[model samples]
Target chain A: MALRLTGYDEVMAQDLIQSTWITAVRRLESFEWKSTLKTWLIGILINVNREQIHKEQKKKETEQVREDTMISKSGTVSGYDIEQGLIQLPIGYRRVIILHDIEGYQHKEIGAILGIEEGTSKSQLFQARKALRNWLTDNSNEE
Target chain B: MKSKMNHEELTPEERAAFDELSNFKLPPASLEARVINELKNQGLIEKQKTMNIYLKWTASVAASVLIFFAGSYWGKQSIENSDIDPNLAYMLILHEDESFRPGDPMAMFEEYGNWMQDIIDRGIKITGHELDNEAVMVKASSETHFGEEATERTSGYFIVEAESREEALEIARKNPHVKYGGTIELKPYVVR
Candidate 1:
């Protein structure tokens, strides 16, 4: 889950996982046990990933813009695989799709985990699927 | 490829892709060791010391015998001196509420085990049991009710021998329950 959420950046995913475990241990006292332990850990991972993204955004703002333009112009992601296509998605779309589809979390659960409304989760899933489909189809045509 | 797929529905190809992604992948072998080491460094978990099998067995037997004799001697002394034992015993009532976050079950067990082991190593007589959710209340009028507030709230209890109330309070203060957002009620046993 951490790897998928971090666009398969192994180093970043490992860092996120390590941070998540430490945070979960330190903050275990605040856990109400209302949800399963797995959900709580995932919640912590998502938060850690969000923080990482925020920090990276400041450093890579110009680089991100250039990459976005290249992607738009090429009509396909740098790689043709579905996982690669997932990396090309906006963070919001990627998260929703990964959690809802790949992780098999319900919209309500996804909303609670992501701290978003159920409607928002549903809408993002729709948009994410559309985007992923378009990317995959365009890449297949290129092949 | 479906040209018009609803938000609620996944196309066959999408489902297959999702299935492929969902297939569990084992993380790096070193990650587990790294996590455990980090946890130990943070003092979140105890560093398990490796001991020789025969030596550990011998030590375990010696400790068991010592604890048994000590407990028996204390038990007899407490009974003979007075109805209320001279050695103060405090009941640590664990109350669980919304804030109590008992993280991983295995980790929680290990934590509690380490805590009780520490108390035992200090030569303090301690005993405890986790309470079950099932509880019933019987009124004086013979009316019985299930799930009383006290029974529902009280998750567990521990009785420990202490030299003084202050010492008992210190023990309670160190309990993982208190650290994990659970309330601990310390009460001295009274003789009727």
Candidate 2:
């Protein structure tokens, strides 16, 4: 449960939440009344995600090097319950959890965006949830 | 009989987990208002009408600049070549005189058409064909009738391409229509 507090917290949350606003503005024309406008905005965020991935790939290709792993120092903060251990899971599994659980995308929509079969999206989601639950259990035992 | 409780529903532990998960607040209200205002100002909503005017002016200025610079650049590149021969690649627009005759107008036109086909087939290189404003009005029959007489002095055009003006004239000499007594005018393309 990521909670709010101070300047550092605000800056970290900026990374997670900033793109939603820009996407809502850029894709105002494409908004249909099918789902909530927020969902449509999320659809645009998926496009932004694809663009970011493309830019990252281009950067990697140009540099011919892999980026370093990221770590946060405030691991034991009260709301930092995700068990920093879960961050070590493969990036694909992490992505599935973030897109599904945190971002609230459905399996079908996730499948469409990621260009995977719906069944594969479901399986990945299940595996990711199971892995996260296990990580939480293991960390709680340590605590 | 007493029934044993299964973990199908949230036990105390499950309830705590749910509460923890749902505790995170929605994004700040001020952030939402700021974002919506920014979106409105960005022309993503009601687009800026002034943009069309700005674009038109920009395009006109750009076109003018491009024309001036491109002409100067092209002139610089071609100056040496032009000195070697004043004409290289240029198009000529010619008006046909009203009174001129070939033996049979229709047959002569057919023969001229055949000549054009032969030139294409042989890959005798040329560029662009433009009918003069006056010549377009001159009937096909009139052109054929005029071709024999005026061809000795004038033609609808002398469209030629060569490394130099001299080469172009030499090429013109081989033209079936340019008779010994006929004239072919050479005009240089003056950059505007």
Candidate 3:
């Protein structure tokens, strides 16, 4: 059985689900039966999320220059132990890690969702795991 | 410690680590209720969009009706401000070729006359003719030919039934003679 979402994971998942509902409603007429309705709806939500993140990044660049300039790669911030680190990773890596680890989706399924090859999805997952493991190691050293 | 034993199988190692890491109990049960309520609020947005579209359509229909009556009122006012004579009609001379045709000056006039006949048939009385460019020269009448005051050159003429000079000029501009640097001089004719 899949684990229940909690903390920032639950919050972020909720945010994504809400945004997905709106996209589904907006594009309901174009829904062909080529793929499952959930997958089609989730695809639109992914694109929407990408656009929102891009706009947010642009806004952050202008208003909060410091926060946007250099990403905190060390990933040991006080509030963000692991949950925030998962969310804070760049979108490409986040998609890989979230699908494989948190969402319990197969690499092939992640590839289908992200429009990437299965091998590429596996590679991305490996990289994301390495980055997270490094962040976790660094976090434990501070303790 | 179990991670070492499970190192050969990356999946079990990662799963065990994730399970151990998320051991902390989740916060209050009210958070799920709050999220579900937020979802309901999001659904109401579509209803608001439909209402907006209906409001816009209502405004458009109202404006169209208002414009219909407003146009009729404007038309009546314009007609009241102007008068048209019965006998006087418009003349248009069109030269289609680079150089005017020899004796075909009456051809374009015939076309104009045919067009105006339809307007006349509709009870809006108007006649139109084409005048030859060479024939439009200031001509002396039989009596004036022998007079000392006979003029050799005069602008072309178009007779249109109008209450005033402005209205006459407005109608005269549509005449073919008004094109190609030709001037249209209007004169009121009394039909015996």
Scored by DockQ, the top model is 1
Give candidates' CA RMSD values in order: 18.3, 29.9, 32.8
Model 2 regions lying over 4 Å from their true place? A1-9, A49-80, A83-91, A98-106, A113-115, A141-143, B1-19, B46-192
Per-residue lDDT of model 2, residues A30-130, tens digit only: 44334433344344544454465455452111221112322223222122444242353444555555555544567787776566788888887666556
TM-score of 2: 0.37
Candidate 2 CAPRI category = incorrect
Tell me the tens digit of each residue's lDDT in model 2 across B39-138. 4576532443433323222122222121212111111111112222224464443333333323222223234434444444454444322221221225
Cα-based lDDT at residue A77, candidate 2: 19
- Identify the superior model by TM-score, candidate 1 or candidate 3: 1
CA lDDT of each prediction against the hidden true structure: 0.62, 0.40, 0.42
TM-score, prediction 3:
0.38
Ranking by lDDT: 1, 3, 2
Residue pairs with clashing backbones, model 1: A31-B101
lDDT of 1 by residue, A1-143 (tens): 77777767778877777787677766655655466445666788888888888887622211231233223233333222567678768888888887877677889999999999999999988888887767665545442
lDDT value for model 3: 0.42
Measured by lDDT, the strongest candidate is 1
